[model samples]
Target: MVSIGEFGSKIKENISRVIVGKEKTIERVLAVLISGGHVLINDVPGVGKTMLARSLAISLGLEFNRLQCTPDLLPGDVTGISILNLKTNEFNFRKGPIFTQILLVDEINRTTPRTQSALLEAMAERQVTVDGRSFQMEKPFFVIATQNPVEFEGTFPLPEAQLDRFSISLTMGYPDEQSERKLLKGISDEHPITSLKPVSGQDELDSVLKQVKEVEIEDSVLQYIISIVNETRSHRDIQLGVSPRGSIALMETARALAGIRGRRFVIPDDVKETACDILSHRIIIKPEARLMRRTNRDVINEIVESLPIPINNEKT
Candidate 1:
């Protein structure tokens, strides 16, 4: 049986064949996946956001589906609709792209709020309701949603409720000169993604997730997580704070991070490292603070720095 760290490393190495110079970003994405959480990639266009999602799905040997969200996209389009089958004389449900193991939602913000709300149930509950009937998604169901951060025209910002559904929100910044050169050369003939093979599958992924849950988290670390969450609620620069769900995500991602590092126990650094990605999108800053140039990331940094790091007595 492959260990969690080995499984993670194999997936990262496979993805890197296509996505260059984003090792840390890939690791964070894997961490979120191991924790059974969805990702929101918020960045400018042409940053390999779609490629990252595709690479991960290919590397994991999962069934991948892409949805190009638009203003005309409807709830039925995403969750599927019941159709009358004249031959059978009854209505039959046709599954949508959401039925797949890995779903890539491209330009998610371009869709209207009603259409955006359609994903909320599927993402949160791993199931969809169509014509008063619910359908459960297959195991290892993961969503990788991307949006352009600088564009607001014809884009409806995701509501806080929907935002909270994503475990981590990240950005894939432009690659450096060396990485870009490598990328250019690599894609000149054929895209590396085409040759990428699955290093792990659903069963191995399930094992890794089980290991992540078993990664020991000390009492102090638990309190540390709570402290940071509490600070978000009372912070003056923020109008809304992270919910208990955010705290849970922080803990789960931290454990996954520890497992990725080949450690059996979580440390303060684990929580601190995953804190920004886990909590940033879930927070809402006040209008005055936004005017003052205070971002949610800035507020989260403040909260993280203000709290004391928990010291673990046992060696990990």
Candidate 2:
């Protein structure tokens, strides 16, 4: 069996073939995968958000499906609909793109709120209901949704309920000068994703996820997580704080990070490292804070920094 680090490294190396100079971003995405949670990639256009989702899906050997969300997209288009069959004279259910293992929702914000709400159930329960019948998704179901941060004309901002479903929200910023030059030179002829192969299979991925749940988290570290979450609720600049789900996400993501680092137990550093990614999107900033140009990330960082580090003997 391949070690967790070795397996993670293989996936990263495969993805890096197409995505350049975003190692941390890749790892955060992998952490969400291992934690069995969805991700929201919020960035400007042409920053390889779609490419990252595609590469991860290909590297994991999962069935990949892309949904180009637009204002005209409907709930039935994403969750599928039951149609009458002419041959048998009975209704037959056809699965939509949401049935795939790795679903990339491109420009998700472009869709209407009703269409966007269709994904909430699937993201939270891993199942969708059609015509009063619920269908469970296949194992290893993961959603990688991308939205353009700078565009709002035709986009509907995802409600807080929908945003909370995503375990982590990250930005794939513009590549550095050297990496950009390399990207321009490398993709001139053909895209590297065409040649990419699966580095790990479904069974191995299941094993990794199982192991992530078993990673030991100390009491002190647990309290540390709670402290940060509690701070968000009482903070004057914040209107809403992290929920119980957010705490669970933080713990699960920290465990996955520990597993990725080849550690049997989680440490304080893991919680600190993943705090922003897990909690940032779940928080709602105050209107006053927004007027002062305060961002959710900044509030999360302040809470993380103000908390004391838990003492643990585990070595990273």
RMSD of each: 1.0, 1.2
Model 1, residue 69: C-alpha shift (Å):
0.5
Stretches of model 2 off by over 4 angstroms after superposition: 314-316
> Candidate 2 residues 111-180, lDDT tens each?
9999999999999999999998999998888999999988889889999999999999999898999999
Q: Can you give the TM-score per candidate against the true fold? A: 0.98, 0.97
TM-score of 2: 0.97
Error of 1 at 56 (Å): 0.7
Tens digit per residue, CA lDDT, model 1, 1-316: 7777898888888899999999999999999989999999999988889889999998999999999998999988898889999999999999988889889999999999999999999899988988888899988889999998898889999999999999999988999999999988888577788888888888898888788888989999999999999999999988888899999999999999888888888899999988988899998899999999988899999899988898787874
List candidate 1 segments past 4 Å from native: none
Write down the lDDT that model 2 would get.
0.91
Displacement of the residue 123 alpha carbon in candidate 1, Å:
0.9
